[model samples]
Target: MKKLNMISMSLFLLAFLGCRSNDNIEYQANLDNAVRKIHSDLQKELNTDVPSLSVYIVSPKGTYFSTVNGANGDLMTRKTYFRFASNTKNFTSAAILKMMQDGWLNLDDKITAHIPGTSISYVPETSDWNFKYKDQITIRELLQHNAGIYDVTNDDSAYHINGQTYTDYMLENFPDHQFSATDYVKVLSQNNLTYGPPNTVYHYSNTGFSILSEIIARVYSQKSNASKTYGNYMYDHIVGPSSKTPLNIKFPELASDKQLPIPYIKGFIKYADHNEITNQKNASAHIGEGNGIGSMEMLSVYIRSLMKAENVLTASSIQQMRTSKGPATTSNYALGCTYVPGVGYGHNGATEGYLSTMLYDPETDFSVIVVLPFWDLRNMNNFEKCLTTLNVTAMEAKKALEY
Candidate 1:
């Protein structure tokens, strides 16, 4: 369960065959066939289940194709906003990398050097093993999921309801609970546990990204000398400055009245049971981990701008962001982005109801973003599970269009 929900969307493409660069008549014919297959696959889902889709693919030249599949609700268009999940990590890391480029912080700087109230701040002299390595963790380690930090979302006692996991509990009980990013980090610190020693291995933890968000907040707070937040910095700097168009992506506050933009698709839980949890109260708890909302068109623009090295980061900074540090694991993840060996760089995001993927190959300048409908938690729960195949389908489309 730990690895399943948070797994990179590119997992199935690990064994993907060689790229086909031939853009001939035969290649075009094959590409058409592949698109037909994908469209048909999505049609099956729209016919029986979810009612929203916003898929946009771009090639090296420019806009390749954009389509709005399924039935669009009266208010829901392909432009409807939805959660970006762990893909939010990309934005957070990009912001931190930008800060590093601006001489505000360095990747190797100790996490405690920035965020003072971390577990590293409270080093208790006891036999408890989980509390030992807090002081040794670095900012780079957290970005790479090698911080050895405890996962509050999955591992914390506070996240457990009765015996079931919090996500499962949410599916069943529909509880209205909200927690701050500090609450999550505090749970990790107080629990005195970690995946492993810092920089020794890789373990994906949303808690680590939440810590990054807090670190970003602290950095911005110090620089501005005011009570600013990570969300404000993201809008004012990250998304706002980079885009050539007006993009509306923001980190929602945990305040009870806060709500996602309307006209969005409702995400489901169990497909067979037909359970729904759209716009739940606590969807915006941890800012950096997986709590971003935006439309697919704007998100694609943000990614393309980054790939073209337009305004997000300098060429050198982009290289720094792409360079892989030690203790690498699956997906060959750098600070925030995932690599496809010699192919491309991208990431995937999944929460309770929404699943999204974004991949861009700099070599060919091909980018694909897939926001699959209603997540199926259990592998055997649904016959036509789209999340399992969305990444591969998007990749196939990329390869086809490139050829």
Candidate 2:
């Protein structure tokens, strides 16, 4: 009687395992179909000359769905690399948090604090700085976009030396010029451009992040007693040895290093009459702010690992990075992340010819990454339409995972 009872229990357990395997297969199939539908709908809506699009979705069960669409879609795969602008801030923020975890720095440290063994402050202190409250800004404020530094790239005033916005002046006259963090700070200072005093309001400033990039280099240099570029530090520490899975993300070390790796989707700037190939534009000017290069799959993997605090950061530090420091212009932004109401923490990136979005939900361990390799320069409204489509794609991908 005992042997018969044991046999019955073993059979029941096998049945249960088989049912779960079937369920997983069904769910994965549903996710794939949903991704294909999203691509089809986008192609239909765009109607004309749709550029390449890539989407990657990952679930807690280790199920993944990926799709590529539009021109040269057949050539693009999950491993294809592209420039992910502004999403670089996520990496920058992670580097700072890693430093904090290692007891190298504090969030509330003032930008004016000198390095341990160096007379140089975290930020450059020179007569060129015209802002009165430069010394009062904190590292946390910069991460939260509350540093009140003027955005040289986004501000729309004739404040530059050429009676044009800094972006316009650079694009028109010096498109090839390699810009550094100090170069941007110098421009803002020489023009006496400031939004307001530090921590007073949330004004998104790329220049603020430029300053943070410099701080990362300075702190790393002082701690290691060796000179290293920010890009090298990132590869050696944050995404290299310290990550759960060493990510394939890269930062452009020089302006002349503009070529993407083989098997990359081509980016373009759409004009009224023609579409110009912009796949090789210099990215040095946007370092730490908008100049990260990786594939959608790698980005999803990185975000998933980051949100889980797996091998990268402590849970407490990740919590602090996710909590909103204060109000923001569009959404509740945390240290280096943007919180979408029902979506998770992530960021959006838009540069000359590419747009990308990445989000990861810790509760569900779900991640969505999307990248498009086209930007309409002439039709500004097209940009909004593209963003909406990307958001819809993410929402649909999330819904598909529920099955």
Candidate 3:
């Protein structure tokens, strides 16, 4: 999906996802019934109206829900393509954990120490990003997005919004758009990019993760005595164990031919006249620490591995990834996911058009994988809502699961 669909998606979601609807009396109904209704709506979208759409509602442990709707409607059961946008952080964080265990680096080590082309002047001005600044951010801070060097309101940056492409805009308008992380380290090795003190605030910066990716590439080359890049290293050590791969994040256009599912809301988008956001059209060369394209089954495969405690990491390390680093945008952000109180740690990704959410609760011995086309479809699978409604309707669904 592309950012071009945000305005429409947002409008649709806002209409149905009530500000107080979750707490409404009628919402507190039976889970199976809720699932059934969701299933029916999904059928309408997939089989009748929304043929280009796909939806998934996997049980916590990866069990298939009887309500998934796709191209084949009730008969379709394929691993449809999906967009992970920003959810890739979880995998990156896990790779960091593996690197840490190998003693190649320390959580407190300065980022410059591992990544070669880094410098001092890259630090920002008019601020105290020096003390807790340059050499202070740790591996943990980088993992949890609390490095204090983030700016979402920077007008100089660009990302897809509404129906406009922002990459070219950044390239043309903001000369500093090229002044990103790894590139910053290379050309401005004598400088650094610091906003505030390390560990002090949680400002989300895709820049931070990009730098981490660079560091991993450098460290793996040296430690393994093979000059192997981070991309290859992650596959061998990190994703290989869990059996997942980086998505095909090449070009993101308005229309796609990759056979990925595409569904639209009838009352919302003018599906026939809409321009497709083709991934082949918008070639995002390297801003991939966030959005990557793949199939829904892959997302489920990765999360299910985590649920089984599939030896992907040591028990202690798994706990570390799940542990909240500090004050994040929410409760506490672990390396990749966030710790939801009374719920498990998980992260939500809202890309231009795709929305993917996954969470695992040890307390309930379950997990949830909800993937939808638009971030705001009123006919959303409502997997998250099922969590809060556990005491009312979802409890019955849990009981009926025969688990």
Candidate 4:
């Protein structure tokens, strides 16, 4: 009787395990189909001349990637590298937090305060330009975009030297110019371009991030007594340590380093009459803000590790980075990350030729990265359609994970 009972119990356990495994398989299949549908729908709706569109989703169930090549016939694969642009902000934020964790700096430290054991200010004091509220802005304010710094890249007013906006003036006149953080600050001061007092408003300023990069370099240099660029510190400390496998992501030290790795997705700038290949444009002008280059797979892995607190930053620090401050009008931006309602905490990137979206839902441990290889900067209708597709892809990915 005992032997018969044991056999029956073993059969029951096997059936239960088999049913669970089948359920998981069904869920994964449904997710893959949903991702495929998203890619198909995007191609049909956009109807634009783009080199490629790719979506990568990582979930507990499995990983799903879908891509569609356009008329250019440049195939975009998981290994194909692309410029991540402003997604580098998240990395910058994480590096700052890591430094904080190491007791090198504090979030509330004033930017004008002298570096520990050094007379140099957190931001180098300069007679070249005057910075408003330089003494009042804290590290936290910059991280949260509450510093009210004038955004030379996106601000519309005259940049004093020319009738055109700063971005237009620079791109047309100095497309290959290598700009430093101090140069950006000088432009802001000379133009008297400011949003208002620090901690009073929320304006997305790439210039503020450039300042943060400077602070990172200064703080590390003063603390360690070793000269290191922001990119070097990041590679050696943050990005390098987090990855279990080698990642190809890199912060280009020079504006002339425009060529991406082999098997890279080409980017295009669409005009009314024709498309221009912009894969070789200088990224130095947007350093520390929008100048990261790497593959989608590497980005996915990095972000997942970041959100999971796995070999990157502590879970508490990650939570702090995701916590939004200031008024409700701040656009749900937290530190260097953005909260996309149901999508998760991540950052988006847009340059002249590429638009990318990244989101990681901590609740579900799901991450979605979508990259489109073309951007129509002048055409609002086309740009809006592209943005809409990215948002939809994220929502669908979240829904698929739930399923």
Among the numbered candidates, top lDDT falls to: 4
Cα-based TM-score, every candidate? 0.78, 0.89, 0.62, 0.90
Least accurate 10 contiguous residues by lDDT in model 1 = 117-126
Per-residue lDDT over 304-351 for candidate 4, one digit per residue giving the tens place of the 0 to 100 score? 888888856889998888885755235889889988888888998987
Encode model 3's per-residue lDDT on 212-329: one tens digit a residue. Answer: 7666766777666676654566567655543344333221321222333442221112133362342221213233355355555556556556545673556677887887476554
In candidate 3, stretches whose alpha carbon ends up further than 4 angstroms from where it belongs are 1-62, 66-78, 114-132, 151-195, 241-275, 281-288, 327-330, 341-343, 375-403
lDDT of 1 by residue, 23-115 (tens): 344445555566556656755654454444445667753454433444532233447777778888888888888888877787887765543
* Steric clash pairs (candidate 1): 23-403
**lDDT (Cα) of model 1:** 0.66
CA RMSD (A), model 2: 2.8
| Per-candidate clashes, comma-separated | 1, 1, 32, 0
Local distance difference test, each candidate = 0.66, 0.78, 0.49, 0.80
Models, CA RMSD each:
11.8, 2.8, 14.5, 2.9
RMSD of 3: 14.5
